[model samples]
Target: MDRAQEGGINDVGIGALFGLVDYRFEILAIMEHARHLEEDYGCGPHTVSFPRIEPAEGTPFSQRENIPHPVSDKDFMKIIAIIRIAMPYTGIIISTRERPELRDQLVRYGVSQISAASETNPGGYDEEGDNTKAKPYEKTGSTGAQFTLGDHRSLDEVISMMIDGGYIPSFCTGCYRKGRVGADFMDLAKPGLIKEYCKPNAMFTFREYLEDYASPETKEKGLRLLKELTQTFPKEELKRRVEGNLCKIGEGERDLYF
Candidate 1:
């Protein structure tokens, strides 16, 4: 983290593989790490990820057969809940390694960031028909990936689900862009006033995505959902600002924020 900051990186994310050891011990260790960073650098982990072990295709059949310390669904939730309450201001990220149902449940357990779409292989995103594959790393021999992914939805599909789940799918990076970091970031997040800026910024970015990137069907649904969501914000002043900014966005104004 210190090296990254010295190299001009402003944010850092950290995590522990939960199933490798006693999860309770790992959580306390993570907390200690966060405190150490803050004491030394005036900033702590910007995000924390929790990933559990899973079976992969390229692993040895014998080792795969004898899995170690697999985390149960109930224990998973309890761990995340404890982390959430322990670090309310930190962004808790859940990856696509878990099934969709489990991912959905993690959102309610204080997960603020999620990997909706990801490709692990090299050149996975390109249109070229490259079929090159890499073997998973093993201490003794080549295997394959350490784990398999569970969620396979596209980004648009995930956004639609988020909307259905009453979450505003925000693409806002306003906090980091605006220099809110370390203690400053926590102040806004803890008091819940950050939403005053983030909500409107999210609407703008969602609008931009709908205009430029979304498929026709997705655009239609996103716009309709955006309209419905706007009505739920009862604060007149905030609503007015959001309305003005949204109109500007529609008029091709970019990066406008509260």
Candidate 2:
């Protein structure tokens, strides 16, 4: 981490697999680590990922009963929520190791990022296609994955579900692009001014995806959500800017952001 900082890459993310050790201990460690970074470099973890262990091929430790300390569904949810409340500005991410229903709930609880349509193995993406789609429900077999995934939905499928859940499928990379990193990101985020950038940036990226990649049904739903969200901004000026960006995205502009 220090090496990366020395090399001028200040942004970093950190995590611990929950089932390897007790979740409580892991959470405390995560908090202290973030605090340490902030004290040392004026920046902490940009994101914190909490992936519960899942069964994997050729690994006894990956099995449910064999895991050193297994985290229950209820406990896992609490952990996510705790992390959210403790570090409100840092992005909390949940991976496909979690079940679909749980992932949905995590979004509501505090997960800001979700990894979908993942190909975990080295050649899995190039050779095997999406293991989530190919082996949606399989848990223990060798399907060319590091571990059996719990959420096996495709990107479009996941987007549809997010829309149903009243959450925009965010692909926003505005903060990094806008040079909001390390201490700089915390400045706006701590006081809530980040919303002025986050929401509009999310819409811009969502618009690009809806225009170029979404299925007809998804596009319809996403556009409607976009329209509704556009009206939600407290500032009319920002809302109008969002409205214009949406138009340009529809008119073939790409990579537009705040």
Candidate 3:
């Protein structure tokens, strides 16, 4: 981290693998680490992820019996809520390491970043699954996979779930592109102003995804989500900009953002 910052890589993420140590100790260490970075660089972590250990194909240690420090579901939720309160500005990531139900529950709670439809093993994406519609995807016994994923839903499936819950499934990368980093990012984030840029960007990206990739049902639900979001947007001028962007997107514009 020190070398990255000194070498001009200002934005970085910090996290602890939950099963590596006691969850209580790991959470504290994560907080302290964030504090350390903030004191030295005037910016804390860009994101914090707490992926619990999952079983891996050849690793005996990954088995429940061999695991050293396992975190229970209840405790994991507490960790998420605590991190949200402690450093509310930082991104909170929930990966596919968690079960689908838990991952769904998490996004509504405190998680701000998530991964879906991921293939961890080398060339894992190329393999065919036996049941594509399984509620929780089964690992296809792919060798070389570092760990098994608990959530096996496709990207569209994941996004559809989020939309069903009235959550905006965002694919925006505008802030980094706009050079919102370090102190600049913090200034907006701490004041909650970043939402003005982020929500609209999310709408833009969601719209783009619906137009290009979403299933017909997903597109309908996603469009409804867009309407709710636009109607509820707090700022008027920015809402107009968002409206314009959405219009342009309908006319084939791509990669628009705040």
Candidate 4:
């Protein structure tokens, strides 16, 4: 389990073998354990717990059971309630398997981040059209890789789509740097402690993309969006930081966020 967490496992981060099996009880235990860890040991920053909500094969969508499975609407609401009471600072990542309208509704109900154009397989990004190979590190006996549910897109495509959908495709990397991690970080984060760092970094990454990867039209659109967002905050200081970061990025800074 610790190995799984270190390897970037999440609710959606299933191994190839686990993906094929219907280990419903085991999955529930995992989710419950995560919840307990966050509540007792302060290990999670965002909502560390996830409900086992994926529907089983041959199950009718309308009659799906809640709890230890893809939660029913009522149970989902209950989960949110529990989260608010026990872990309000934690964020949820709603998978793409839900209906588009349902997914949108979840976003409104405090889902802080989402995956787009996600490929479960390690080389899936490079494979593009092929869908047969399992992700490099996925366990054996796993189901074959499955495509993302929404418009099949790459990260770039997803960013563009988010922009079109009137959302900021944030690449903020503040929490990791600020030493504000786990549930305790939430107390510091509640009043926007890290926004000071996050905003500048987000702008810096956005600016780098605008100047480098984006086409003139994309640059124009991104700039327009930036202008609108920046106007809401006094961002002169952030602008300076962004410029400095952009310079470092141009100088081949590797592993920087966008």
Candidate 5:
């Protein structure tokens, strides 16, 4: 994925490929696979996919063997190394299970995105911090209880913190909308077409955030940041597209990115 991004390919999204057993090994495999993708196929701007990793059914929380605990410093360093290698191009997104310390470490290592207040279950947010119903919905074929991290903050708090920390908490939803995926999309995206879609989408989402969620001070800061970013990129057509799309985002789509 790094190579693809470096080579100017922009459409690929790589999954984290996590599984049961050692998360250490899983992290290593993710790094290795990303490295291979960068070295060989030139996939760039990758997304680190998060699949639910849960203990087997009926296993009590205390006895759950495969659950991820806070990673040790050594393992954290390895994760950092992987992130640093991929940071030049790909976007790393860590899900909610990661401990606050680990999340801080990964942020230091250049993780670019995150999911805040995520629930695996449908309609889970309606309950809002209720752990019992936050479990994965049966319709989704998920069996384990839901998990929360980092004090189960509201979306506003998370985004506020993200902004204060100097990260772009993007709520982009372009890849699916743009019809850019699968094997065929990869070929056209090799020259950075995906970035064309993603950048504008990010800007629009940021704008929508300001319009809907920002406090006066946050809105001021966000606008300043947006102005600076626009200056850096300087693409009028893309700017226009972003403005147009911002209107399409429904009023109800509030807490998806946090």
Candidate 6:
């Protein structure tokens, strides 16, 4: 943490790879690490990734064969919930290491960020320019990745899934852009008032994605979901502003936020 700060890095993510030791002890140690960062450097982790061990290509036979403490789906859910309760403001990032069903459940259990469409190998993002196409959704046995992933869905698919689950896929960075960090961000999040800004930001961003990036099928469903979610916002004034902002985005404007 200190080294990151010294290097002028404002945001740093901290995590302990699960399955090495007792998860209970690890969670407490993670909390203590966060506390230490705050106490000393005035900033704790910006995000945390809870990844379990998975076999990767080229791993030594002996290392790959050795069994470690395994984390079950149920226990993983408990860890996410505990972390959410322990650190209300820190962004919890769940990777694609968990299966789709498990990832879905974790989202509802306090996972805020997820790598729904991740490719571990180089050039995986390029389809035409590079020979390395998007790797198949599977464990990292065929390629060189630190760990294998479970979820293999694309970004569009993930967005559609989020809508189906009644969640607006967000691309907003308002809080961070506005310099909210450390204790300040936590204070707002702890009281549950961050949603006042986050909800509208999500709607606007989703509107933008639907207008520009979404496929015809995804756009149709996404817009319908957006309309439905709009009606659910309690404050008429805020809702009106969100509608206006979404309208602006549709007019080719961008980067609107609360």
Question: Taking the tens digit of each residue's C-alpha lDDT, what string does model 3 give over 1-258?
Answer: 767877898688999888878888988998998998888988889899988888888788889888798888999999999999999999999888889999999887799998988767665553354333233234554456678889989889999999988889899989889999887898888889898788889999999999999999999999988987888867798778888999899899999987
Off-target runs (Cα >4 Å) in candidate 2 are 127-144
TM-score of 3: 0.92
Off by over 4 Å in 3: 126-142
TM-scores, each model vs. reference? 0.82, 0.92, 0.92, 0.58, 0.60, 0.86
Which model is ahead, 2 or 4, in terms of TM-score? Answer: 2
Which parts of model 6 have CA positions greater than 4 angstroms off? 6-8, 61-65, 127-142
Candidate 5 ranges beyond 4 A from true positions: 1-24, 31-46, 50-70, 83-91, 120-123, 127-144, 183-193, 234-258
Candidate 1 — which residues are off by over 4 angstroms? Answer: 2-9, 61-64, 127-146
Local error of candidate 3 at 58, Å? 2.3
Which lDDT value does model 4 have at 71?
A: 39
Please tell me which predicted candidate would have the highest lDDT against the true structure: 3
Compose the digit string of candidate 6's lDDT tens values, residues 1-258: 778777877778999888888899999999999988888877678788898877666665314346367777789999999998888778899888789988888899999998767767654667543433656547543555666678888788888888889888998888888876556776676678888888888888889899988989999999998888888878898788878887888899999987
Cα lDDT for residue 246, model 3?
Answer: 94
lDDT of 2 by residue, 80-149 (tens): 8999999998889899988899898889999999988886765455354545344432554556568887
Candidate 2 global TM-score = 0.92
For model 1, what is the C-alpha lDDT against the true structure? Answer: 0.77
For candidate 4, write residues 1-258 as lDDT tens digits.
445445554212211112223445444544576565555544544543333334433344423343223435655555544444444445665555555555555555666566655555446654444544435445554433442244344445545655666666566665666555644465565555756656656766666666666666666777777667665566676565555565676586634642
Better of 1 and 2 by TM-score: 2
Clashing pairs in 1: 136-143, 136-144
Q: Per model, state how many residue pairs clash.
A: 2, 0, 0, 10, 4, 0
As for lDDT, the candidate ahead, 2 or 6, is 2
